[model samples]
Target: MLGCIWQYFYSSFLRFWLKWFLRHITGKCELQRICAGYKQGALRTSQIGKNCNKIIILTLLRFEEDVVDCVAQIMRHKNISEQKDPMFKVNLQQCLLQISGYNTLFAAVEDLRKEVFDSENEDHEKICGDLLMPSEKLESRITKQWGNIGFQGDDPKTDFRGMGMLGLVNLNNCGCAFQCRYSYAIVGINLTEMAYSLLRSGALKTHFYNTVAGKPEMQNFHQLYCYLAYEFNKFWVDEEPESIMEFNTYREKFHDKVKVYLQEPEVALILKLDAKN
Candidate 1:
C-alpha cells in the first residue's frame, strides 16, 4: 500500500520537481544526463526510452534513417543545447538507432518465422540437407537419415512447424559452423525457439546495444542465434546430463545464465569462433 502510494506521489508530483532540480543543478535534462552518465548499451538506452515521451519513441519505431531529426526534436523538447553537450546528440542518435533497429530485427524475424518451410524448394532442401550431411547424399526425402542429425522422424519438414524457416536458417547458418556434440539439426531448431523467445521478450537489448553501434540487421539476430547455439552446446556437454531427458532442465539453466550476463551493461553475447576448441 505504501509502495503504491509512493509510486503514485512520485510520478504525479515528485518526478517533475526532481527533474527540474537536477536540470537546475547540472544544466542537463534527464535524457542528456542519461546519455552522459550511463555507459552505452542497454543501461543508457533503456533509461532514455523509459524517461522520454512514449509518443515520440513509438513514432520512430518504423524509422530506418533520418534518426537525426528525431534526436533534434527530442533536444528541442528537452531544451538541450548541442553546443554545450555535443556528444549528447551523437549518443542519443545511436540509442535511437539501436531502439529502432531492435524493432526492425524483430519484424524481420517474425516474417521469416511465418514463412513455412517448403519441402519442394531446392534451396530449402539444399540448405537443410547440406547443414546436416555435407558429404553424404540422402537416401530419400523421407528416409531415416534425418534421425542422424536429431530429427524425430523420417521427414524433417514437420519439425519446422514452430519456428518455420527461422529454425532451418539458424541450423544451417550457425549449427554447421561448429562441430556439435548434440543432435545437430534438431537441437539447433530447439535453440532457435529459445533465441526467438528471448528476442520476443526484449531480453537481447543489452547484447545488441553493446555489440551493434547503429541499427541491428537480420545478420545480427543470426549471429546471436549462433552464440546461443554454440554456448548451449558447450554448456550441455560440460553439465554432463544423465540423459537427453534432462535437456529442458539444462536449457533453462543455460537460459538463466545468459539472462544474468544480459543484465550487465557490457554484455556482448558473441560466439568466439577461435575459442571453439
Candidate 2:
C-alpha cells in the first residue's frame, strides 16, 4: 500500500506539492524545538558549570523517545500520494519543534556569559576556546548568532529571513574578549535590515523596540535619545555608518516627531541618509 502510494505521488509535480504541504505543517514547530534545546543546554552549562558532554548526552536521552516516535509514525502513516497526512506530518512537526526550542534556549544561555565569567580572568579564555573548538561548535556560532536557522517560508524563491536583529544585537553584546571575525559587521548590517522589516510587520512589536516604544510619547522620546547616545558611542566600531546609522537616525527622528510633530531645533541636523538608490 505504501509503495503504491509512493509510486503514484513520486512524480515531479506531486512530490513538490507533498513536500511543501508537509513542510508547512512541520517547519515552525521543528525550528522552535531546536532553538529551545540549544537554550537549555547553554543555560545548564552557564548556571551549573556542567560540562558540555553531559548536557548533550542528557538532552539526547530526554528527547530520544519523542524522536523515535516521530520516525516510526512517519514510516507507518506517511502517504506519498497525499499532500497532507496528519499523523506523519504532525509527528514530524513536533520533532522539529523540539529541536528549534532547544536551539533558542542554547542561544539565550550562551549570551549570559558576561554574568557567568570574570572579564579579566583566564577562565574566560579557556571557556571560549572550548566553545569555539571544532567539535564543540553548535550549528556554527557565527551563523546561528546571525539567525541562520534554515527554513523556507511562503516565498518559494527565497529562504525565510533568519533572526537578524535580535541575533546580531545579542552577538554585539556577547563580550567574549576576542577579536571576532570581520565578517560579523557586514552580517550585522544585513541582519539589522531584516529585523527592521520584522519590526515594521509588527511581529517584534513586543520585543526590545516595543518595550522602548511602550512608554508615553515624551518618555519614549527620552528613551530613544538614550539609545541613540549608546549607538553613537559604538559608531566607530563598524567604521562605515552608512547602513546602521542611517536607519537608526531615522527611527530616532520618527520617534521624536511622534512625540511632537511640529517641534524644531535651532541647529542644522546632519542626517547621514541611507543610500536607497
Candidate 3:
C-alpha cells in the first residue's frame, strides 16, 4: 500500500516538474494553447486541423491572450463581428473549413429550382402523400396544402421554382403522418427558417462548431435542422401562445435557449420526434 502511494506521488511530482520545465522552455506551445481553447470552448476541434497548417506561424506568435478573449466573447454570446476579430482566429478557421459543407447544402437547395412539377414529375404524387385531391384540381389542391404547410398563393409550384426540389422534399417530409397531427408542415418550415436565421445571425457557428467539430458533414448539418424541428414543435404547444403572430417573439427565445445549450461540451443536439409520446 505504501509502495502504491509513493508511485502516485512520484508520478504527480514528475508531471508538475515537466509542466514547469516546459513552461519555462517553451513559453507555452501553440498545440497546448489550442487544446486549452478546445477544452474551454474557445477553440473547436474542427478549427484545429487548419491551424496545423499555420503551426509554424501560430507557434511563433503569442495568441494566448486572444484565446482568453475569444472564449470570453463566446461565453457572452457576442455578435458576429467577433468572428472577424483576431481573438477568434481559431473560431474563424473553423467557419472557413465548414464553408464547403454550407455550400453543399445551398447548392442542393438551388438544384431543386430546376425540377418543375408537371406530369413528368414522378415525385409530385410522392410529395403529396395522404393529402389527396382530384387530378385536374392539382394546382389548387397543391396550393391549399402548401398554405396548410405555410406557403403563400394559389400557385404553390411557382414557389418551388427556385429551390423547388429541395424545399419540396423538406415540406413533404413535415406534412407526412406523424402521430396523426404532430408533424405539421407549418411548424417544420418555421424551424427551417429559425435555423437559417441563427446561421445568418452567426450564433449557429458556436453550436455548429461544437456539434461537428472535426469533420463537418452534410448529414450533421441536416441533423441540426432536424433537432430544431423536433424541439420547436414541443416548444410551440407547450407555450400555448395565442397564435402564430407571437412566433417572432418565441423564435428569439428559442435561439437563446440553443446558445445556452451549446455551452456544454457533452450536451448533444439530437432529433427525436414521436407524436404518441
Candidate 4:
C-alpha cells in the first residue's frame, strides 16, 4: 500500500512537471495557433493544465504510433462489435458533449445510438438492395458481402448491435456509392473504428474544438466518416498493401495525415466530397 502511494505521487509529480515544461514551449512551436485560444480569457489560467494535455495528445497523434493496435490489444478479450466500451484509450465523452461547438453533434450522436432500424421507420428495400434480395439467397449473400466486411456470418443485422442505425447508414452509403470495390463496407467500418480511436485518444476533441462551426450535427460526423472511407481506400491502393492484416498499420499512417491536415489553423472538419468526386 505504501509503495502504491509513493508510485502514484511520483507519477503525478512527473506529470505536473511535464505540463509546466509543455506550457512554456507550446507558444514556441509551429502549433501555436492551436494553443492561441486557450490563452484567451474564455479559458482560465487554471485550465492551462487541460489545454496542455490536449496539446500533448495532438502532438502524439502526429506520430505513426499504432493507436488502433493498442485499442485492439485492450479489447482482445471483449466484443468491440457488441459494445462501445468507453473508449479505453481516451475519456473524451464529457469533453465532447460539454464543448459548445460540439454539444449539438454529441446530442445527434446520442440520438443515432438510440435509434434502431425497423420497417416502420425505415426504407426496407433500400437497405437490402441487391445485397439481400430474394429470401432464398439471403444466407449466401449475407455471408459473401457482409463477411467480406468482417461480420461473422450470414446476417449483418445482428452485427450492428452497438453501432446503431449509424452503422447501417454508413454501410448503405458506401455500398451504394462504390459497388465495384468490395471495400465499401470494410472502409466504412474502418472509419468507424478510426472515429473511436480519435475519441479515445482525445485527439479528435482537439481537432473538433478548433475546426467545427456553430452547432455541429450527426450530418457532420457522417460526412467525416465518408471522407475517411473514401480517402483511406485510395491510401490503401497507393500503399498496395499485400493483405488486409495491414489495416491498423495503414490506419495509423492515415491518422498521421489527418493530424498533419489539422495543423492548419484554417482547417475545418468539413470535407468537400463533391470536389473529391
Best by lDDT: 1
User: In model 1, which regions exceed 4 Å deviation?
Assistant: 177-180, 274-276
Where's the lowest-lDDT run of ten residues in candidate 4?
88-97
Which stretches in model 3 have alpha-carbon errors above 4 Å?
1-28, 36-43, 46-150, 158-166, 174-183, 200-202, 263-267, 273-277
Candidate numbers sorted by lDDT from highest down: 1, 3, 4, 2
For TM-score, the strongest prediction is 1
lDDT of 2 by residue, 1-277 (tens): 9998778768647866765675578652322223233333222222222211344334442444544544444344433222433343343334333343334333443333223333244554334334323244434323343222211222111221243223323333432212232323333333334333433442322222213211112222223333333333344354454553364564454444322421221111122323741
Query: For model 1, how does the per-residue alpha-carbon lDDT over 1-277 read when each residue is reduced to its tens digit?
Result: 9999999999999999999999899988888889999988788888887887778777865775657778888888878888989999999999888988888899999999989999999988888887558888998888998888888999999999999999988887776644547577777788899888889999899899888988999999999998898788778888999998898899889989988888887889988866535
Candidate 4 lDDT, 45-164, residue by residue in tens:
124324434533333323224334333442353333214333322322212222433534555565665566553444643564454332334444345655644565556666556666
TM-score of 2: 0.23
Ranking by TM-score: 1, 3, 4, 2
**Candidate 3: 10-residue stretch with minimal lDDT:** 55-64
In order, candidate lDDTs are 0.86, 0.34, 0.52, 0.51
TM per candidate: 0.94, 0.23, 0.53, 0.51
Let me know the TM-score candidate 4 reaches against the reference structure.
0.51
lDDT of 1 at 19: 91
lDDT of 3 by residue, 1-277 (tens): 9999888987779766865687579554343445445653324454443444344223322333443443444434423333434555455444334433444444454445355655345567556433422233454443555454455545456555544454455555443332234435445555555655555454555555555643344456556776776676667678888877787898778878887876664556767666764
> Each prediction's Cα RMSD?
1.7, 21.9, 14.2, 14.8
Native-to-model Cα distance after best TM-score fit, residue 221 in candidate 3, in Å: 2.3
